[model samples]
Target: MADWDDGYWWSADGLRLHYRDYPGEGLPILCIPGLTRNARDFADVADRLKGRHRLILIELRGRGESAYAKDPMSYVPLTYLQDVQLLIDELKLDRFIMFGTSLGGMITALLATSNAGRLAGALINDVGPVIDPAGMARIRSYVGKSISYPTWLHAARGIAETQTSNFPDFGLHDWLAMAKRLCRLTPAGRIVYDYDMAIAEPFRVPGGGEPGVDMWPVLNALKDIPTLLVRGGLSDLLKPDTAKRMLETLPQMEEVVIGRVGHTPTLSEPPCIAGIDRLLARIAAAG
Candidate 1:
């Protein structure tokens, strides 16, 4: 049996988009990936929640199986946010839990402020209102660059070399798994990044590189809801102080910081999984 059914929807601009549908009962968990990531990043989360909750792992435009945008500028966050809303409408979701990572997390924050009533719960992964300049520079350095590997082994090694410090505990096996998620095999037998290289075009615009939102209001919107905040202990994107301020903003918020990880933590970690479970439990209890 297939683990998930292939799902597709159309973006407002007429681009076809895709997602992984892991069916179950009760409130669904809408999983969103980072800027360069796709539905594959949520595989572990789906594996854990498959039979327990409906999981919709979205692949934003220009990533994975989704069609690339005709207008490169449409790759901005506002477009992504609009795409997600369209998906929500397409699915007719009355209320749902959000599992957003990095750029996805920003979308969650925006939704929290605009669609507060539709949110059952939220898990903001490895991001806050303020993004660390160091992390911003690091992301700008590599996003949208065209690089391909002749073999899977070479692809795994390339990912490991660049991400070793972020995930110190990841082994060759782990890296190979990640490489499979982040890359795709071309018909010519070369492996390359799964996203459109043109998605980086917006970053070249003045003040367009950063999310630029005053996120405090976005965060405050979650105050009345059951929100879970996750951070990587060694993360350069979301500093410890920012995480602390997030907690201060909503004292009742639940937090999980996975030690030794940087940038973001895969929800597969024990602590991260437990935090998600706790949020789900709270949502269930309230309903």
Candidate 2:
């Protein structure tokens, strides 16, 4: 197992946040996970890359060990960006590589646009500037629901049902592993996901439900940065056409397509590692 320390910091609103800090010798790789996901999502990848670079896996407010926001509206991307900036400042980091997945990828895009000079390189997994409407709807359908399971097996099965279409090759072992990462076993013997259900407030409207944000400007802002984008073949959130558009706008960007998955890819996937390596090399060559 890769060695790391559990870190804590306060968001601007005084809510405490958590992150996993894997200290290493070279450049840093800060990982921002998908919405509603916790830091553990990057465990496998962190372990693999810990030997080469420092790894920081962040838990946004309301996820993992981070303090939940009293005001649910604090879950927006720009708000999350503020938290990330605070983390970077607190750590005294000058520059680092960013590895973002899903909503995390969107956050990374905004960061690239806002402060592309601070990044060594970046890799966005299974996300793009123009998120597909169907994908957002699918995310909204289950994000705030109060769902629980009676046993670990049940929870694992639930995860399989929820994600199998995106990960068609996943077996019992894969689902079980993901269950540990996605859910927390309560003292009462029930299994619940590790996120605050209130984080979904922005999406839930009085009559229309959750609304999506426009991120075209943020994506266009990453013009000069070296970036790698990953897409799942079965993904509904980031369609191929949008990915192509990203390539067109950010001429300096590259991409990798993973087969048989839906929303995102684990950074440990062979192809994902290759993409990361490509970005890392560019970062090294720049210095």
Candidate 3:
């Protein structure tokens, strides 16, 4: 069994960013979780890939065990990019491959563009430059809201009901696992999600605001690097048309669509795992 260790890296803004390091012999692969998610999201995937790669899962500021920023505005993507850089520096890793899902993917895209030299390659799961507005709006609706449930079973049921669109195949145990990962028990005996919900407030405020700065320029910067993009076949956020366009723009990019999945494909699924194996093989061959 691979041992997982917890560590912290201090950010430029004085925040302590938490992370999990799964020990392995080969190259390092940094796993970045989705919006409102934490390092535990990759637990199963990390276990699967442990022998081949050292999996480093970061708990971005305001999420997981990481400290929340005093300034809620610091929760934006740019701040996250800086935090990633700080993490890399603390780890003393010269180069690393990235596995990013959703919001994490956006950060990967930003790094691939601004600091290509530091990246070995990138694997973006179910996210791209152009996001669906309806999806964004839906996310905004719950991003910052406080969640309260009478019991873990109730919370699991809530996730099953509300997230059915994204995870239709998840079973009871899966929901329980998700609940465990997302919430923690406090001294007062109340269960609360690990993330500071306030971090999501900025997105809720009505503002077409700067149109989310074009990321095509960043994607263009990843042209020479080996890249793999995984899209859920039923995803509403990264539509098939957009994925096709992404491939058109980056001819070297490889892609896979996991069937019966939506928004994001948790790599634990067999098909998704197979796709990842192929992707890592390609990266190894290229090296």
TM-score of each: 0.97, 0.94, 0.94
- Sorted on lDDT, highest at the top, how do the candidates line up? 1, 2, 3
- Quickly count the clashes in candidate 2: 2
Model 3 stretches astray by more than 4 angstroms: 206-211
Q: Model 2: per-residue lDDT, tens digit, 120-192?
A: 7888888886668898888888897888999878988998988888899998988888888889988898999
Q: Runs in model 1 with CA error above 4 Å?
A: none
- Candidate 2 lDDT score at position 51: 72
Candidate with top lDDT is 1
- Superposed by TM-score, candidate 1 places the C-alpha of residue 183 at a distance from the truth, in angstroms, of 0.5
Error of 3 at 97 (Å): 0.4
CA error at residue 137 for candidate 3, angstroms: 0.9
Q: How accurate is candidate 3 locally (lDDT)?
A: 0.83
RMSD to the true structure for each prediction, in A, is 1.1, 2.0, 1.9
TM match of model 1 to true structure: 0.97
Q: List the residue pairs that clash in candidate 3.
A: none
lDDT for each candidate structure: 0.90, 0.85, 0.83
Please write out the lDDT profile of model 3 over residues 1-287, one tens digit for every residue: 43698989998989988999998877799999988899988999898889779999999999989999998888888888889988887788877889999999989888776666778788899998888887787777777778777678887887778778888888999888888877777777666777998877678566531136788877897787778899998887898888998999887788888888887787777777877787778777877
TM-score of 3: 0.94
Q: Please give me the total number of clashing residue pairs in predicted model 1.
A: 0
